[model samples]
Target chain A: MVEKDVIVNSDAGIHARPAMMIVREAMKYPCEVMLIKDSVEADAKSIMSVLGLAIISGSKLTIRAHGEGETELVDFLINLIEKDFRV
Target chain B: MRKLTVRYFIEGEGRIDLQLRLYAGEGGLDKEIKYGEINRPGLALAGFFDYFAYDRIQIFGQGETAFMNQLSYEQKMKTYSDFFSYDLLCCIFTHDYVPDKLFLEFAEKKNVPIFLSKRGTTRFITLFVHVIDEIFAEQVTLHATLVDVFGVGVLLTGKSGVGKSETALELIERGHRLVADDMVIVKKIDESLLMGAGSEILKHHIEIRGIGIVNVREIFGIRSVRNRKRIEMVILLEEWDSAKEYDRLGLDDKKYSILDIEVPYITVPVRPGRNIPVIIETAALNQRLKKIGINSARELDEKIKKWIMTEGQK
Candidate 1:
């Protein structure tokens, strides 16, 4: 498994639209994806789960991926979160 | 879903047999009832059809029938013709009142179905509206598991094989009620409220990865399952990743918009040794506390800020 911690840079945090974007990306890879916030964790591949974390502009999040394309999945999520999931 | 026809309201599956008998305009039984609301067309009957909502089913109570009886035959014909000029879905006369000749003639001429109910206006309205609401409410299917935790509706959502059903099973074992599993039909009952229910075939049935399908109501008894619930919050379970920085303070009052209404939301990572069911339970209770204006994190932040002020003064 591969993991990386990134800070959310979006002003609105991971709201519905951004959460859906992340889930869309997460589903592209065939790896198991998860996100952690403090003691809580969520499925990165589920829009509802991603929004559940309520990751705000300054909030930090850990993205983890397992199975085949774990490294690529982790890198993509980190970049996505850092870029505020633009569009 | 689209609006239901008048005939379907009486003969459809889950139909409410309110003993509604047709008095006139039987040919208009196929007319569609768009809104679930009933209207008393007193104004329209009094020759004021300016704001007449033709889409609604008119209710002619005793007051309306008596008023019609007081009018002369020619006057009543004019009133009925003018009223029926607008395309109404139907007209229902309460208290089993028979339609007058002019009313029946106008109903037949205008192709507006007329129904008679034995129940009073208030009782029949209540029952008819209740049935109509069920048929006409806006609905959308969601891939999620819904459970009731401490009377708060908690919807568990995640990708395939993300342990959503497993977490729901644990919650069910802990004395919570399971509203739906796998496929939840979320209905927008009002502007700010959403209600969720399972498909009839999948009601109370949860599918675990290896265990196949398990019936929650059968295993956990009737108290463990409910037909539907008002969704209050959503908890998403995901695999654990060491590199992501999860929300530690929870100061962000996050919301998930479903059917335009925002609901409280949380994400719990799924990993070995993490008790997700307990976290969901606590999350539900915390939501309740927030509803009552008890925010622990905000209160603590204020307390810390006050402490710092006193320390600096010293």
Candidate 2:
């Protein structure tokens, strides 16, 4: 599994807009996307799972994936966050 | 401390076809050279003969003299066995001729995947190696978007056309950096730290309303486009809804999770002329303030309640 952790820089956390965007992106790939924080794991595409996180700014989160060119996809997301959610 | 050994990481699914036990001895490819960068013909041929003496050798390559040579064949079937290797995997064959029957027989004996690609180059193969490195490295990525607002990493995400680019562009104009554009890549270096960057195709390119695509590096120079950053915040853009109850006070927290990490987020509704860029900027700045343990929204709410109580007493 390829994984990267990023702090939730936005004040809103993974709410409607961000959640939808992430879910939309996650659905495009033929792999498993998991959002993990602390010891809890959630599916990247689910609205309820995202909302359940209650992530605040500075809260660290991990995105893990497997299968079908997952390395590239995982890298793409990691860069996005490393750039501080700029993309 | 013998750290040098062949290590195989099995992924997907597969089984060893034949019960093949490899051996190294005097007669075969073993007597050639010590296991290392066997680029020298002496070393390679040494390895070749040593292995070949045991069974047939399947040397894969492009046609580079240093690797595989078939042009030497028409005259005589050189002292070698079969040769094969994909263009994308390995190349540089010495000749263009096919291997002899002995070599073919060995390949048939050992069912190896013989693939050939006419396209791609050495650089492409290098990329394949890089990816394999990442896999072996076991690096993980988080689903996220990173934009710079006042030098702060603010990951913007939302449905298509929710104004992420517009806000990022606006923030850029306000003297903030643009980390990644549409997508972001996050890699975990350790248990606590995270690194991020932009995709090769979309790096430094942000699309605006009238402008189709503008290169941030070309226009704003390199400083505006960062290679990576530790994601500090996530700002989500959403369409303004009259029925929806938005976060009036910034006390309520939201988070976008990735790669087993929890990233904080802020939801900003888009409607009319509310300055989203400014709000995002303030959000980032506010996050910075919160880092120091100063909650502006909470403090303001507290002041308002105090004032209301005092006014009632008056």
For each candidate, what is the lDDT?
A: 0.81, 0.56
Per-residue C-alpha lDDT of model 2 across residues B1-314, encoded as one tens digit per residue: 01221111111122211212222111221122112221312333433533322221222344333343433543222433323221111111122334445434433444322222332334434443443333322243333356766666788777645677777777777778887766565665445545567655556776554665578889988767787777778777889988999998888777776566677777889997999987887898899898889998889989989999998679
Best by lDDT: 1
Best by TM-score: 1
TM-score of each: 0.73, 0.45
Single-chain TM-score of chain A, each candidate? 0.92, 0.83
DockQ of each: 0.03, 0.03
Model 1 regions lying over 4 Å from their true place:
A1-87, B16-24, B105-111, B118-134, B311-313
lDDT of 1 by residue, A1-87 (tens): 898888888899887677767877887888888888764556676544555456788888888899888898888778877777763
Scanning candidate 2 chain B in windows of ten residues, the lowest lDDT window is B1-10
Sequence-dependent TM-score of model 2 = 0.45
